[model samples]
Target: MYDFNSINDYLNTKIIGQTIIQYDNLTSTYAKDKNIFNTCPDGTVVLSENQSKCTVRFGNKWICREDKNIYLSIILKPIGKNLMISKFDVIGCSSVCEAVADTCNVECKIKWPNDVMINNNKISSVSCDFVGKSDDPSGVIISMVVNANMGTDEIDKINEEIKNSSTSLKIETGTDVHRELIIGHILNNVEKHYDEFMKQGTIISAVSSCIHNSAIVNKTISVMKRGKKTVRKLYAKSIDGEGRLVVADEKENEEILSPGETIIIYEGKA
Candidate 1:
């Protein structure tokens, strides 16, 4: 259980975690109970011990171990902020990387846009969902799931591809980590980076951070092309200036896809 009273003891933030709502279970923290955004203040966090039906990009099931990980969604009302929704992706991804590195003392890599990888296995993930229409939006939900303390037995339940690519802090470090402490650090980090982003109003810092710790660049990986169901093998060349991925296919055809254009996952041995 996340002790609400003690969470503030670890927090050192101005926003992005001023309020947190905890639940024992939910379908998914992003949509099901997201009505809280209407009333709650900005940067409110909706946390759950377990999600009965949690899905990642393209409806892929996220095997959430009850009470064994950090499953939370941050609600942000950016409509009044006069900011682009895509900017939150930068804050979310970079914040997670910084927090994990600080808390776990392990090198973390960003898989394309936002997923965090440790030694090639996914140890954490950040999913940023924009509310309302594409051109116009009201809010954004940054859902994150960090594999904090799950062991090998718990991770084995996942099927082959995911099982092989997923990992946890406990499994990698051979120790149990305090979940609340990680969440607290993440909240504080997000706020700090977010304020910097607002002050500068630029995302090049984020682009540099991702490129510096890229996981897919210089590696062969599978990317489900935009508006297509089938995944393709592509050699990711690098991330461009605007944070778009520059990848090349079998025929040496190069294509650039923005962060929202496609989903990148490890399908085969790279």
Candidate 2:
């Protein structure tokens, strides 16, 4: 079993309230238990080994790579009543990518809603589901998976594919890194940002700084809308309070976009 010590150690270092769980695996028999396990306040994290099986039925993909990844879920009871659960996924992705870059000195990018890419290749994917909502405004549950287990050969192939698209820490610095430490660093950074966001309102200026530092701001890209036929190219101006991308066309007209909108942000003309 993977050690929960790292998570425990992190929680000890921070003022945030959290809970940690380490399990071998679980079945549907304990689904309720799993849900209850995450019902804590913000910063509560559930870490398990070979836990629940990933299935397409849940709109989740089981990305199996050796053992160089951290599969963990964080339960957060956000402070405000107006907090949008949808924004957490995007925020989590952006924060995680930034955390990885800052810790490893590698460049990373977010693929739309919740995927992280290193050197144009997929390194991590994040998915979330709302179990329930409280009338008094509780919090949200964010399940995140960070792939830190890619082998050198896998990294090489990923680098080749993303040479023109993305980058990874190992590829950039040519050094092997500890996946656990990376995961811990990411969690710590995320906690810091989450706290800041709770203190400050989610305005474009306040949040854009973090997003901009991650190289994800003001890029021209194409976004495909859900249940629609047309894909439009626009400059991703900023992300709004609702977590929608505020995109602009050639005429600088703006539009708000939700998930299922495929976006391609690169060095090409949009």
Candidate 3:
């Protein structure tokens, strides 16, 4: 049994958690956070023990069991000079990767736009949604789902099909992990990285961080864009300033792809 109150109380004392709301159970923290985005504070964090209908980057269901994962959404009001959604995505994904590595001793990489991977298997997913425009916005709600503390048998029992493509901290480290600790680490890292982003006042720093820690950069990959018929196989060159995937084909023809679906073709390839 996890101590929700203790963790929530401790988290509220942190920088990113001015006001924290912890639901021992919920249908979807992301949906709920979006619903009350206007009323929440600038750095309000909504956490749940169980999310029955959690969603990831492509609106795919994030299979989460009761009291077994880190499911939360943070509502942030961008107060910086130039705040783009793409920059925020980079910050969020990088934050998760740093936090996971710091806590689990596993070096994870960003799989562009949002997914965090360890050994080519997804260990966490981050999704950012902005209600209004870049000039004038209500708030940016970032929903993150980190598969923490889930055992191999637990993951296999929940979604056997995706077990091969997905992984958790416990599965990688071969020990039970504390979800509360991981959440704390993530929130702290988000705040730290966000401050760095604010100081630079550009997405260049964010993009640089992603490129350095990316798992898909300089690798052969197949990209599947939304509503596109054909899949393109190209070498992932790097992440552009705007967070787009810059890829080139054999002919050396290059294309900058906006945030979409990308699959790494080879393992351990730079």
**Which has the greatest lDDT?**
1
Give the candidates in order of lDDT, highest first. Answer: 1, 3, 2
Off by over 4 Å in 1: 80-86, 218-224, 229-242, 247-255, 265-270
Query: Could you tell me the C-alpha RMSD of candidate 3 in Å?
Result: 3.1
Per-residue lDDT tens digits for candidate 2, residues 1-270, read 555575455443353325565555543212423467444555666655544554311264544333445666666666554666446666677667766777777777666566677655656666654445545545665666665645556645543443333333455557766665666766775576576667664534324533564334577776665556776778878766666667789998877766544444445311
The order by descending TM-score is 3, 1, 2
lDDT of 3 by residue, 138-210 (tens): 7688889998878878778765557768888888999888777777777877777666655666566557768
Lowest lDDT 10-residue stretch of candidate 1: 78-87
Q: For residues 1-270, could you state the per-residue lDDT of candidate 1 as single tens digits?
A: 777777788899877778888899988888753666678887888888998987765566776888888888887775455555446666677778878888889999988776888887888777777777656777778888889899998889888878988899999888998888888888987777667666665666666777778877888988886778998889999776555788998999999877777777665422
- What is the Cα-based TM-score of model 3? 0.87
Q: List the residue pairs that clash in candidate 2.
A: 68-148, 68-149, 77-139, 119-166, 119-167, 120-166
2 against 3, candidate with superior TM-score: 3
Task: List candidate 3 segments past 4 Å from native.
Answer: 1-15, 80-83, 133-136, 203-205, 260-270
Cα error, candidate 2, residue 259 (Å): 2.8
Predicted structure with the largest TM-score when compared to the true one: 3
Q: Which regions in candidate 2 have their CA more than 4 angstroms from the true location?
A: 10-17, 26-34, 37-39, 55-62, 133-138, 152-176, 201-206, 213-216, 260-270
